[model samples]
Target: MDIDAWWGIIGQARAAVGDRADDRDSPDDPLPGALVDVLAVLEPADIIDFYVKHIEVTDAAERYPLMWASFLIEGSVSGDGFMDFRDGLALLGRETFSRAVADPDSLADLPVVVRMSRDEGGWIGFEALSLPITDAYRRVRGETDTLRAAVEAAIDGMTRPERPGGGTWDPEDDDAMRLHLPRLAALFLD
Candidate 1:
């Protein structure tokens, strides 16, 4: 992955989101609006390619604990739910979000993301976020199995009991997810 290129895209998206000159009425939710604006200017496919390449190059498992944590905190506080938050990240386009993941510390100034570092649920949120990515990665790679079935298979094979309740994080779960991310990257990215 071209790290510099990824940073450039992120810088552009942030600037666009922050721009006050565009007289357009800002949505009550700025993040989503910013994301839509960014998407309008960039190719989604290229962003996804950058994301897949990022996962391939970065030791995501070891590197992203904080990013996932922040997502959890942001989700809980915003009441956006993890899935919706992930979708928003998707809308921001992969490159932007990938930069967030690679350098979560940069997000610490954001009130919602700051809570993630302090809250217990951050890790859990991180784990929850991984599931859909894994499924999408598998599908993007043309895996014939259903996403549910694949998720079930992965969960079933786990040595520890699943994290109780819907939105909790488990270290073992994170480990399992880390192992799969590269495969996920390999599937759709050339």
Candidate 2:
């Protein structure tokens, strides 16, 4: 996607999250779901940085969202307490993030895909990473169309308006990943 497109998306996502927060019964309500939507469009490493900047959870289960985000980015869960690569993706594919999260465990298994790039020594790192959705996986048990529809529905589902008490919707939240576009473009030029 182009930078402008990403900016638009981030704005939408942030608005969605802020809106949800307003409706929350508690001030400290977990922001995982909406934040997940925002991170979904970003590279794994950037996702990690975002959480480090935003989350204050000291517990493992609470940290699952960040762990899962990292898993999606790096494709492996190496480190203290994280699942190995194959299992990590399987867990996410199976929608088991809420169940199999392990926090406080030192993450050991970094994705080989991410590890291989550390030698590049460039900020252009991971600009080419794309959200690798696949039809074959969606076809598991002949559910390709169903899965596609589900994904589309989820993306569409993010369009609800902000609740009365929700913070003002900032369009940048939905497409925060766009913040990296300049870096990505620079990578391309190199």
Identify the leading candidate in terms of lDDT. 1
TM per model?
Answer: 0.33, 0.21
Positional deviation of residue 109's Cα in model 2 after best superposition, in angstroms = 46
What tens digits encode model 1's per-residue C-alpha lDDT throughout 1-190? 3766654554554566664312112334343344334433444344344444333323232233432443334433222344344334433444545655554433444333333345422211222323333433443544424444544554455454222122233423545334433222122121
Off-target runs (Cα >4 Å) in candidate 1 are 19-27, 43-45, 54-110, 113-190
Q: Which pairs of residues clash in candidate 1, taking residues 3 or more apart in a chain or in different chains?
A: 124-168, 124-169
**How good is model 2 by TM-score?**
0.21
Candidate 2 per-residue C-alpha lDDT over 52-124 given as tens digits, one digit per residue, 9 for 90 to 100: 2221111223333444433333434433323233222221221232233332111223232223234322110
Best model number under TM-score: 1
As a whole number from 0 to 100, the lDDT of residue 170 in candidate 2 is: 28
Q: 14 in model 1: Cα distance from truth in Å?
A: 1.4
Off by over 4 Å in 2: 1-12, 26-31, 55-190
